[model samples]
Target: MQETPLCLRVGHFLPYSMSDLNTTDFTNPSTFILVGIPGLEAAHIWISIPFCAMYVIAVLGNFSILFIVRREPSLHGPMFYFLCMLAVTDLVMSTTTIPKMLSIFWFNSREISFSACLTQMYFIHCFSTMESGILVAMAFDRYVAICNPRRHSTILTNSVVAKIGLAVVLRSGILALPYPFLTRRWPYCRTNIIPHFCCGHIAVVKLACADIRINSYYGQFDLFSVIGMDVFFIAMSYTQILRAIFCLPTKDARLKTFGTCISHVCTILVLYIPELFFSLMYRFGHNVPLHFLVLIPSVFHPVPPVLHPIIYGVRTKQIRGRLLQLFTHKEI
Candidate 1:
């Protein structure tokens, strides 16, 4: 089998003889190189300091939330259960990308196996999508608690959370299957240097030699059906909750109710802003910004994980008191 110099670069595919395709072995590329921060070669080391710190904080903060939620009996209600699940999802989501990103920046270990890259892409997208569903679930939790206080317990009981959690996991896992499957079938006849730290779906897919119109269409369809729909429902839930809050006679009651939602709202903003920014950038055109290359997969990916725990811990009385007890106890 003769290897040809045919590769797919941005905006152009290098030409080669049909004979080369016939003669070449056509086996998939075994590995891909991760080029972290395309042109920022000199600053990779400088970037590592804050990137590493962000990852550590994400892990510790989410874990602390999980531990506090699990140990406290009063916090075992539907709201805290959803929160604990969010912490777990956040831990997995950031940890999936950040460690490898740090390795790429600090140690220059940028090689990833083809199969392993697909696996990472699957879980990364899966947990991210799952978090959206979890947010909607948390919103429903708030909706019921505020909009219909007496039935809140009955509606979001242990059985209900378990079912909602299972549905969220299944939805993400199922939808995440197509991209990696489609990617595996695309022919990679060129240099396999990925421009990001981790194997994002579009990042890896663009390297293919085949026509990717269907892939692009399906990607848009998936995003709208999954993320777009989640956003719609979350907005609807909040709207209903706001209407319910306004109908209350007392200002103190309204303030208290709105306060409960502050943490969730912050979590929503942190998760979606950077993600939607990149999505829109990629949707309109091909060229991605340098900061999106350098910052998103490393820094912003961990922001929700780190921020969610802090926001919830401080805003929610039960979680705040429990966490303070653990930290401030003289016996410890």
Candidate 2:
């Protein structure tokens, strides 16, 4: 595989191959050049330590949430079910890139194999899709609780919840499968040093020697379709929820319903806003700094899950009481 000549520069960053790059091309080129983040030395020192600390906190926070939900029988419902799934997604999401990122930052090692890069890309996309689907499912659950409270249990039964979980996993799994196939098929021509910590689609596909019209088109389409549709559904569900809250006969009922959804609403905005911005910036904003682009998602990715349990447990009195009971009993 021959490296594609740099024809034109986009800002200081050089795109690996403006031509086709995919998984099918097996030939390894002779030259591997390091590209990305102009000042690695400064970046390593300034960012790595704090990022490592955040990763530890993220892991512990989500783990605590997972345990709280599992041990408390009072918390077992559609809401907590979805919350548990979200915890799992966060666990995978933070674990995906942070460790390797810390390694690269600390050791000045940026080299990654074609196989490993593709694997990282796959998990990143998979977990991202799963997170989106889980948010959509949660919105629907909230809608039922507020709008149609009488039939909430009937509508969101154990079987229905199980099916929703299966559907979310299967949907994300299927959508993400094509990404690895597309990446693995492309021939590697340029250096494999990815700009970001993980093998992001934009970073990896930029190195293809083969025509990547299909891959790029598919990638963009998947990005908008999954993220766009999920956001739309979530927004619609919330809109209806707000309308119902306003129309409720009793002020207390409205307040109660709104209170129940407060944590979820906060989580939704926290998780979705950065995602929305990243999608738009990646698609349209060319001058966006690589560090800025990576930083936005990295900060938000760990947050929703880490704080989700804490918010819901503390706000929901029954769950909080049960969790406190568990802690006191354990100490005893």
Candidate 3:
């Protein structure tokens, strides 16, 4: 008998046959396979346990912040409003990737449609940009409350806060608009395997067979323009805040004023430190192991969401008091 064709023999074992792999539609693949983390497939189950716990904490903590902020009148201030925005951004950011990521890890369901992959990529970047903008707003709130206390309320009026929130949303949406379009325009003739839990813009773009100079350049430009500008503004705001804090005559007064900013500083550090590391690793750490490269984004994305509410809840007096009251009331 004649030997069976390789495509026919393997057709039952794979989604695509050997022949189909060679003839896959370059410009429009039906689906892309996410390999989670390369070289760590055997440990996906173990890896997912902490991730799942973090996701649960992130969801509950952010929701609790939102609910407490909404219900408690004492927490109604410009800073708290900004905190609400931050909570919502964190919730959406984590939600956008974690569920699908869990599905991949638990069920080995890694195939994501091209359009769906692009949508995930867009939401991840958009919310990340929004989170950075929200942090800047929080820093500005702290600066005004400290350095310009006389006009803090007037400067960050309800109307002004609403306008700032609108601006952040519009800026993030517009800046992130180009990412999906840029990635889509390229023809992806290479293998459809993306070695990540979610569709990262650079990860997806690298799979394209065409030259991706524009994609790479735009990614750099977008990262620097948004994150760089936000960081600069936050630093300037804090510098002014510190100067104002030191001008207070009493040591206790200076400490009291500075205490107000500790939470914001902590929040900024948690967000930017990991983000900077992830960006640098991707751009320059060519010698870094593939698993490390994949794990960084996985850790950074959900970690801030899990930590932000805890930081705010514990550090902000009104939030902490209200939380204690809430739990105590439950006990009674």
Candidate 4:
């Protein structure tokens, strides 16, 4: 027989067994589990039930808010415009991941195809950025309303609000585009198991065959940039709001300004603080606790959207009144 080249022999090299051929030699697949809840599958059944319930509430609440904003003449202002955008964002955000989560939980099919996983991850990032953008826009609206009430009518007019809404979607879309593209570029050399209920940044990145240094850099930069920018803008807005409130000649103005922003403050803290902790934990404390995996991202995912309408509805009299009136009225 003709002498075979060393490269050809090396290429055909088999390491002792058929199991080696079947198994992914690059990395271990069994270590990462796809359990959404720890301890008990029974408990997970219960937890997923509530999680699905929360998604329903999120959908209904956000739809109600959207309907109220669109139908009401008096609510055709910047505040309600931002509110409508938020409602849409929340609806999309919940819908993006909840269906997959519920499907997996009920049917026990945790196998997400490459395309499906990437698509889910894309929307998760998209709406998340949109929500952040909406919040920032809301803060600016508040700042204008309190800091310069005279110009609120002129500055935050319908056209202005529409422009801002467009900008929000555009910016978010641009920022989140890199995630899916970059994610798809890297080949997966091992198991495609994704922890948690959805395709998240961390869960997807862990499977990359190539060096993910750029992914990590982008992740850090994007997280801090988005979060930091939001905090900075919100703080500046609130400072102006507080200044306007404190310097006010009337108690009603001060109280109204303070009260209006109270809802926003609550929403911001609830959404961001957990995210900050989780970002830090994921960046540095990834090795510490398994519970942190469930704890960190879960707080930001379904909870923020579910809680947004509730907090604003309970805290803001106008929004609450409109929402109540919409449901209480029967068909004549």
Candidate 5:
């Protein structure tokens, strides 16, 4: 082996300290190596700049949304509540991938333990799935508010919102449990290198020695079915919403509903468009460069959390007024 440089920053990827001997053998558990920016190691420093910016903004943006929503009583409606949930899931998804991603780009640390990788894989998938689930719920909230304005409050009470939140958490978390558990049982006899900064389901499966047809099929099925259902419901809700708006007697009413939906449409595009593209590319595009491929989804991962409140909170009259009023009063 070539003598490593003094700045050879290759170390196991984790917050805690572990010996260099940590590996898959009788002495230690399995370790999957993360290949960070192969053939373009020179650009890792420049690559992390925007990624770190996005991560910090996402965390701060989501935290601020949670705080502002809790502080103001006027923002206690179901739509905002579901927006809060979306912010939370975005935070989880970003956090699951970004810190280690930054580590790989900054310090060149890319080794991750098997158990830790599995946990990371679980949460990364889980929270993303949860985001879509919450979006569907948000669509239901909008549908009720627009279609049956009189019964909106009656149908979507605080209890109902809480239930929807719980259901989103459970569905995303529980259904994703099997993939990690089963993947662990497989014999990963091939080289342990994962060609990404973080643990992804398809990446991890590709490293296994045993047949992964079951896991692949199950993952794809679960991905499409659970997330597909959410997409279907969201589409139907919007369709009904449009129907209700058109049935109104005045063009002003239709415009009003259109204005209300702008933020939601933007949010949906930010959350799903990149995600769907990532899923499809992983399934079919073997020729794609890992550096470019990873960059695409990683860039979009934080867009929703960082932009949601800016779009929804800043544009919504009540929330904007309250935020401005708070700042003005505090300045005194």
Candidate 6:
């Protein structure tokens, strides 16, 4: 028999060949492949059409809110200031993920470098946390306005709103700072195929061969500490607002008082309900269909951004009037 080559002899003792070891770096992958949806890959183009439309609508609606709020002097109250912040948050959140998703759908350009993936992951989670904090702030605004009308202006002054906005930013940034770092430390000996459009925290972390209990436990801690506390505060605020509404002397008064809260309530529901569903599906839906797993997050990301500005524009009298003036070129 011919003498075996040294490389072949070595390969017989090793799990991988010399060529394989030279070509593939298991500890640090150069790039990751992102899939739109595992089972529905055939319909990516069709799915992208509606997603593109929603992105357009979301961009236009949020820009309109910012423009109208800034231009109109009548809307310069604490409430409208908070509205502007919310619009900004929605704009960033949607812009962070949707364009890349559309690119994936349209061009099959799914390879993202490891660093770029971490950057995307950071923005997605940071903005999500920020949005939750802003909603809590909005709830507090309503609570003060309804429950303690006398001190509303004094309590939520310009300075206070600015401070609250800063706090939201800081909290979100700090909470999301660890995600990229935590993910980066892991050795990606496993495949670098992420089954979701965006680089979600859990999805990316799952690809690591290292033990991920720290990641999992910290993720749960972050989620509950931010979202859970926010939900509790929002609930308390609304409870007080409801009691105040019931105590109003006349039916007209009650209707009018609750009317101011309708838009906020709708916004809160739109933001939180889908988010909660997605969270539950991730944690407890081991037997859930793969398509549903993909679909929930795909919908959850874009739907709230599309609905938030529309809800406010339709529900707020000032915004609606300004929109009418904008389109009609005449005073409403």
RMSD of each: 5.0, 4.8, 5.8, 7.9, 5.7, 7.4
Model 1 residue runs over 4 Å out of place are: 1-27, 287-297, 330-332
Global lDDT scores for all candidate models: 0.79, 0.74, 0.84, 0.73, 0.77, 0.84
Q: Kindly list the per-residue Cα lDDT of model 6 for residues 1-332, writing each as its tens digit.
A: 11122112223332223344322447777887776676676788999998999999999999999999999999988899888988898999999889999998899887789999999999988999999999999999999999999999899999999999999999999999999999999887646667678898887887777787788888889888888999999999999999999999999999999999999999889988888778767755766765677776897689888998899999999999999999999977
| Better TM-score candidate (2, 4) | 4
Candidate 5 lDDT tens digits, 158-268: 999999999999999998898788778877643566667788887777766567788888888887897689889999999999999889889997898878888888888
lDDT of 2 by residue, 188-226 (tens): 744444455567776666667777777778888898899
Residue 12, model 4: Cα distance from true site in angstroms: 32
Please give the range of 10 consecutive residues that has the lowest summed lDDT in model 2: 2-11
Question: Which lDDT value does model 3 have at 197?
Answer: 87
In candidate 3, list every pair of residues with a backbone clash: none
RMSD of 3: 5.8
Which is superior by lDDT, 1 or 5? Answer: 1
Which of 2 and 6 is ahead in lDDT? 6
* Candidate 6: 10-residue stretch with minimal lDDT: 1-10
Q: In model 6, which runs have C-alpha deviations exceeding 4 angstroms?
A: 1-25
Pitting candidate 2 against candidate 6, the one with the higher TM-score is 6
How big is the positional error of residue 184 in model 2, measured in Å on the Cα after superposition?
1.4
Stronger candidate by lDDT (5 vs 6): 6
lDDT of 1 at 53: 84
Q: Compared to the true structure, candidate 3 yields what TM-score?
A: 0.92
Model 4's alpha-carbon lDDT is: 0.73
**Please, what's the RMSD in Å of model 4?**
7.9
lDDT of 4 at 238: 87
Q: Tens digits of per-residue lDDT for model 1 on 83-159?
A: 98899899898888888888887888878999999999899879989999999899889889989999988888899
- Among all windows of ten consecutive residues in candidate 4, which has the lowest summed lDDT? 1-10
